[model samples]
Structure formats: structure tokens, C-alpha cells
Target: MTADLQLWPIGNCQVSALLNAAGSIVWSCVPRVDGDPAFCALLDTAEDGNPPRGIWSAELVDQVEVRSRYLRNTPVLSTVLTDARGGSVEMLSFCPRFERSGRMYRPVAYGRIIRPLAGSPRLRMRLAPTKNWGDPDVARTNGTNHARYLCDAHTLRLSTDAPVGHILEERAFRVERAHHFFLGPDEPFVGNIGREVSRMCDLTIDYWRYWVRSLATPFEWQDAVIRAAITLKLCQHEETGAIVAALTTSIPEAPHSERNWDYRYCWIRDAYYTVQALNRLGALDVLEKYLSYLRNIVDEMQEGAIQPLFAVSGESELPEAEAEKLPGYRGMGPVRIGNAAALQTQHDVYGQIILPTIQSFCDQRLFRMSERADFERLESVGELAWKMHDQPDAGLWEFRTRSAVHTYSAVMSWAACDRLAKAAAMVGLADRAKFWSDRAEKVRETIEAEAWHAESGRFGASFGRDDVDASLLQLVDMRFLSPDDPRFIATFEAIEERLRRGEHMLRYDSEDDFGLPETAFNICTFWLIEALFLVGRKEEARTLFEQMLARRTESGLLSEDMDFETGELWGNFPQTYSLVGIINCAGLLSVPWSQMR
Candidate 1:
């Protein structure tokens, strides 16, 4: 079994790290989220004769219990580990990232402060960061107050107010006063170490609190929604405005399922849902920044062609390969790095790309107003959607073994044309508006004719396949069909009967590359919840939504896959897709401010 880690994440957009419940720092990618995991023990389990490597742990001797929590509304995690003898140490951990000199100074670093809380607690500091996935040995050169770790191409320097020898030795020592440890790029730390960290901590805390205050959230699940929002915001690569799929890689969808895959790169479909849900809460900064990323990706596309996903830096070629690294999550082998799905033609990307840009034209809150040129550039994407709406390709599921014209992709293509029709009218282009409107009607009619399984009284997964997929719930959610439409209601009923396994929803019951799925995809369940809410099943939707929220880790975050029978969270962590569900459902179910007043 894998080490059951209830991870708490601390990040400043440029970088992020995860800390397990026992205060073991694991699963942080250096330089960027998609970079090599400097600390990767989250994916490794301790085996006999060999201790788990690539983890930073500060253990209090004879520790009996540990408690961890985020400070109020911030990502700053304050963990306290206590011994049976009543001695305890409090740890304040974060990646220092706030506005400095009117610029975001989010470095590839971590700041940790350890303090003696109770009696004298002996602490051991093990800072064994790894490089190149499997390689964990780094040569250390020590100075008076800092240790320069020269390994591979990267040089990491650790500066501490405490004795450098004590930390380098990984030996036990008594905690006297507050001790500060700063690990980042090799550079000389200026001024007093304690004072600098203290100031950064206070400012970071203030930055998070102030950022949360701007969110317009539901009264009942406000805390839950805010946590999800903060995590989603942290997933974005602030430098390039690109948001990653998740923070880690190689966490399998099910135990020994061989379904492990990396999720650090940005997918247009996932990022679309993420920014859209946050936009519901009046969080336009994410939308604004992502649009810039979108512009760059589109401008670089050859003949307006789009991929399912891309590297955060907009690199198009991501050749999927296995990392021969420190045993996988629980020693489940075949750790993967880059994703091959990037090379697939998922036609739904047209709508995913266009959906966020639609806001740019209409939302006056944005600084870069959409112009005729912007709409024309988007028309190129719309053309692809129109041409390929009925043609066969790898659908949204990214199936490797086979290809078909998925109903969901066709509907998304329809949405592209449909929205463009409205947007064109908004900009007073009557001729262009009617042109796209006619195309939208054609796509809709084709879907109604080809996708409907009349004998089953529901839509199938693809044109010829008589299989059910929970993603069809998006038909109503995406506005392809009205919530009260009989066709949608029938499809919803069909999905629940076939795909809903207790409180969870399966992406599909059919077998593909892997055998039948062992665990439910979390976002499919969220889509189910949203579908329920739209169909006037408010009570059922809220109850199921609550049950899903209960499945979140201790830190109130979720991974990509969940087991309905076992309640085990798998797949990549702090999944942007799952968090989008939290925000979307909270916004739907919460009583409006007008009603509250």
C-alpha cells in the first residue's frame, strides 16, 4: 500500500510543494511545476533494507501525534508535532511569494521556521532533495552559515540561522529559540535571516488573506469554495499565465492499475473549466492572465490547429516517456514524465479554447477588450470545429487504442459556432452572425440525428457506439440542450442508471486501453452533480455534492480519481478539474446575496 499522505500544499505561483500529514515535505517540482521533482517521496513507499529517499522531514524525537492545518484563509501551513513526553515543535512552512517592489517575487525556494513550543523537543532535519527523478545524491559544500548543494545542473543553497553542521549532519538537537531555514537558488541572503523570513511570512499571510477577501462565495460552503479557488489559482504558471493539470505525476488512478500518468502540463479542456468556474466568483485575474497564454498558443498553432494539452511554456512537442525513478507511488512502477496525449487531436479543444475568449469580448472588466481582429483570429478555430464536428478523432477521453466521432466533441464544436453567432451579433456583424448561426444549427441537427440512440431513448458515447458516458451530462451544462429538454432528461437518466456507481460516476463502463476502470474519475461525478442541479434536482445535487466534498483530503483538496467503494483519492493532486466542481456547485446551490439580505 502507498503511504497514506494527506498532503498540504504551499506555493507562490512560480513554484509549489506538498507536505504530508506528518510534516514530510514531498512532491515539489523545482523551477516550475513541470520541472523535475526536487522532493518526490510522496510517490515512494519505504521498503525493508532501503529507506525512502528524496524527502525533507523534521521529526521531533518520540513523536506520538501530529496536527497540521492551513492558517485561516492562507496556503501557509502551520504544523505541530508533539512527543509522548509532552515536548512539541511548531513548524511554519511556505514558499515566499508575494508582491515585492511592485513585482511578483516567487522564487524556486521554500521557507521554514521551527520553534520550541512546549518542553525541549529534540529535532532532526533531513533535507535530501533529488534531481533527474531517480538520482538523489548531491555533493554538499558547506560555509559558515549556509550549505551550497551542487548537483547536476542546478545549485541549491540552504541558509539557516541555526548551526549549519547540525542540519547537514541530520543529527538530533534541542530547539532553543525560533530557527529559520531558507532553501532556494544559490545566492547570498541579505540582512538578518530571521528578520527577512519573518517579514516574508507576514507579507505572504497578508497576501493570501487579502486575496481571499476578493472572492464572492456562497455563505454555507464559503470556506470550502475558497480553498478550492486558492489551489486552482496556485496551479497557474504565473510567468506565462499557463495553468497546469495538477502538481504531481505517476499517482495511479487505481492500485497497480498501470494507469499512472503525469499531470503537470496544461490542458485546454481542464484550464477552460478552471477559469470559467473562477469567473463565476468574479475572479477575473485568472481569466485575464490565461487569455494571454491562449493568445500565444493560438498565434503559434499551425493553420489554427490545436492540441489537447501543452507544456506551461507553450512547448508543443511532449514525447511521453517513463521515468526510471525511485519506485512509483507505492512502488507502482512505470513512472511517466511527458504526456503523449499532447499529440492527439481532441476536437473539443476548439470550444475549450473559444469558451474563455468569449468573455474577453463581452466582459468590460477586462483591460484588453476583444476587437474585430481578435474575433477573426477566433474564427479560424471555429472553422476547424465546423469542419471536423462530424469527422472522427480521439474524443475528449483521449482514448489511445481507437478513435470515433464523440458526441461530446460535436456538441462542443456546436457550442463554438453557437457562441460565435452571439458574439458576432454583440459586435454588430449581422451578416457574420447569421453565417455562424446557420453552421451551429447544422451541427446541432447532425448531433440530434446521428448521436441519439432512439431504442435506448438517450444519446450514446459516439455516433455508432451504443455506450453511455457521463460526459453527456455536459450537454445541458454546456447549453447544447436546455435543462428541461426531454432529450437531456432522458440522457441524464440513462447516465445515472449506467455510469453512476453509488455516489461516484464512471467516465464510461466500456473497456479501452486499460481494462474496465477500477476507480471513478472525480470530474465525471462533478459533472453529474452539475447536471442534477440544472435538472431541478436541487436536493439530490446538494447531497451528492456534500458527499463528494467529504471525500476531499484533510486539507480540503481533491485528486483526479476517487474510489467510491474504498474512498481512496488517486491520480494527480489538487486537481484543477475537481476544484472547478467545488466552485461551480457552491455557486449554483448557495443562496444569493440578494436573498440573504
Candidate 2:
């Protein structure tokens, strides 16, 4: 069995140093974006997966103490371990430095593990890698002082400048005072990895510091907001403008249950909110790139409609399958990938994608003549929205077992048409403007008359069901109703009564449909923050915001769901929607309406 562990917070910083209870450095991912895992034991259990093939094992000592932290604002992670035998080991991981070429990009990763022997503790380091989710077809080749593991489409080379011996299980060992290992793909190790590592470390630190400096508010919760923002930024695939939902997937919503789903791809519905949050932070550059990415997808696809989600690089066909080989995190079975929701018809995609693109263009003041083609392209997209508005879609949740004419989905469809009408008028497409505007008005009338549940005094989840949904809270943020209107207040109270448990908010009760237990949706909690702020409850809003921020882990990470009963994180970690909520709420709290305009 693995030893007990305790994670120590690095001062007030958002980084956590994970150490065995006995005080040893076992696993960490740091320094560079997409760096190789230094301690990958967290990915799989010991019995079903191979351990790192290295001489560094805390089990060799009677007792150990380990601690770590980042070097200021940089991504570099530094860890130190001290053994009962008076021996100490320090490890550092960082990315190499490179100047960003306006078009092409190059990045490198560096890791160094150093140990000083005090009284012959007999140190040994083992290095072993299971290629492509621990498939056993890995091939290994020995180098002068290191080894290489190669498999189809993947290669890992470990080189050390110290004396090293190979073990029977394709591991490496060193008994000297100091040892270093360089690991990467078969690509040439170019551009002074060591110097680049130091320089890149400094550069990353400066980048984060400078970015955080631009924030207008250092509110009580600014620390958590900054960390969450940084993590969100890290999750963005720099090469492509896609923002993935999380770094890893298949973490169960309820331990030992099969509710785990892959979140490593971008979702269309998350586009507008994500861009809105970034735009509020004065990060127009990120919004611009993401909008360009959305346009690229529309430009490349033969069809006007969009999938629910897509790969970071715009790959459309992601086949869903189960990985029965490895036991899932916390024994959640049937780990899944390639979300099946992508195939579902989510009509909200029209508004979610286009409204944000239009918003970004307006926010960034990108009114150059060159932008006309992009504006025209969006107008073309609006035509597609007009066609989809009347169709029955899977709605926002992508319910698997049934379909309904979801009311929130229709509301967003109306929003798309309304934005398109504005865009058309702005560009002198007066005929198109009138057509979309008339259609939008009709939809709005239909929603207000048919979608509202008079008896319950709020918008229903769908025209078919009277149940209230957390999504209706968007009506206030989207400005579909006056905040102080009696009907709007009634709807807000109904949502709070039906969907909220204390400070935790559920998306909706799924017991009647999916048989899933009620859990807090992080995004919905932020919606409550916005709803409260809008409806003249500013103190209550700020109080709830702080409470939600406290729910984040020591490293300031939040998952998709939080267990209402235990306050434990459930579902996927570092969900994009959750981070986007944080950014949006922060903007509402920090920036005044005049400045926002």
C-alpha cells in the first residue's frame, strides 16, 4: 500500500506541496505547460499500474518530510525532502525559454533531481513509463547513462549526466551526490535546456505577475480569483484557442459510481461566458483568439450547425469508448472519453457561439474594414440560427434518455436572433435585420406566454415540465427581465426555494429523470451571485461569493459538482464553466457599470 500523505500549502500561494506522511517527494507536475509527470502515481493505483522507474523511493527511509512551492509567480515547482538518516533531496522542474514567433511556437521542459548523501542511505532511482494509458506494448532502449521508452506515436527519453545503472525492470539508478535527468520526446533536445529553463521560469513568473497587476480589484477574494484565473489560462491550449473543461477526466461525481465523463474538450455553450469573463478582465487578446477559433470552425465545417463540443484542435469525430483496463479514480468504473454529447442537437450553440463572437468584436473595437468579412460570416451564421430556432434540440444538459423543448434553450435562441438583428443593422443589412428582429419578437412573446409557469411563479425547465431549473437565473443576467419586476422576483425566489440547499445550488433535481443525486453546480452558484447582485441584494451576494470561494481546495481548484452533504468536490476538476463563473462574478463585483460599458 502507498504511504499516507499530507499536502502542505505553500504559504498563501495557490500551489500545494504533496508529501508522504513520512515526508518524501513522490509526484508533481510543474515548470512547463504539458510537462511530463514527475510523480505520476496519482494517475493510477500501484497494483494495476507501473511505478516511476527511478531510484528515488521514500520507502527506503524510516521517516521523511517533504515540502514544495513555486518560485514566485513562475510555473517552476520546487520540492525538498529530508530523510530520517539525515539525507536530503531537492527537485526542480521548469520549462525552457523561447521567444514567441508571431506564427510558429517552440517550448521545452526541464527537470532536475539532486540528492546529498549524509551517511550512505543507499539511494536508487527507477524510471519506468507505460505508454498511452499504460498499454504494455512499450519498447525500451538503453543509452549511455539513461534509457528511452518508445511506442507508437509516443516516445520518452531520459538522459542523465551522472553515473547510472540499469535494473532488470528497465529502471535507472544513481548513487552519487548530485544527479540530473532530461526527459522529452524523440525530438532533438535543442536550445540550452538548462539556461532556457531558468529564463522561461523567470519569464512565466513575470507574465503572471504582470497579468495579475492589471486587475482593478484586490478584493478579499482576489487571491483565489487570481489562482483560478491562472489555472484557467493554463488549461487553454496555446497552440489552438480551445479551452478544455479540465486537465484530467473520469473522476467520479460520487465515489465508486459510474457518473464520470471526459471533459478534455471544448464545449460550444461555454464560449460566450468564457469570452465574457476574459473580456471583463481586459484580456481582449484571449477573447479575440477564441472568437477566431470559433470562426475557423464555422468556416471549416460544411454544415452550419455545431457539435456540442470539439477537440482542442477542432477535430470533430471523437469516438466514445470505455477504458476497462485501468481502475478509475476512486474505483469509479468504465472510464470514458470522446464525449457522446457532441452528437446531440443543442440549439443553444447558435447563441452561445455567435453572441460571444459579436460581443468580442464590439468589446475589442475591431471595426476595421478587414473585420467586415468576419462580420459577414457571422451574419451568415445568423441565417443558420434562424433555421435551427424552430427545431427540437437536446437542450443545454444534453439529456441522454429523453428530449424536450427546453425553455432556456428557446430563450437563448431568441438571444441569438436578437444579436443577429443588431449586427445586421450595424452593417447596413436592413432587410436581414428586420427579418431576424421580427422572428425574435415572436419567440420572446411565445416564451413569456407559454414557457412561464404561472402556478409556480417562475420559468419552467421545459414547456412539458413544471420543474424549475437553475438556468432560468440567466434570464436576469441576460437582461430578459427587469431585476425588480414582480414576475422576475417570483421566478428568482422559486429557483432559490427549489434548486438551492443552503449556499449550494443544484442544476436541477434529476431524481425524477436520471436518478442522479442532487449536487451543487459551481456555475449555478455564481449565477446566484449575479442574481443577488442584480436584484438589490449586494451584501448577500458578496457573502455568498466568499462562501463559494472557500469551497475551493487549498490550490484554488474547483470541480463541476460539489457534494451538498459533505462539501467534498465531486465530478470533474477545474471545470471551465466554474472558472468562467468566477471571472464573471469578479467582474460584476469589481467593475462599475459605467466602466464596463
After superposition, the stretches of candidate 1 with alpha carbons farther than 4 Å from their true spots are 1-3, 594-597
lDDT of 2 by residue, 1-597 (tens): 112112221210111123333333333232221223233333456564645321123223443666666555444456665568766666554433334665322332334545554544434444444434435456878755566667444465666655544332434343356555555556554565445434544565566677667755434456666766666655566566776676556767666667778776788777567667766666655666677678878887556677778877788887777765556664555667568888888888877777776664344354322245766777666666767665677778777777777777778878888987777777677897798899889888878877788777777878746877788888866667788888888888988887888888888876633476557888988998988998889888888888887777644557788877777777766677888887778767664545544
Q: What's the distance in Å from true for residue 103, model 2?
A: 5.9
Residue 135 alpha-carbon offset, candidate 1, angstroms: 0.6
Index of the highest-TM-score prediction: 1
**Candidate 2 segments exceeding 4 Å error:** 1-43, 47-63, 85-90, 95-126, 162-181, 191-193, 214-218, 363-370, 512-514, 590-597
Model 2 compared with the native: what TM-score?
A: 0.84
- Model 1 alpha-carbon miss at residue 471, Å: 0.8
Alpha carbon deviation, residue 333, candidate 1 (Å): 1.7
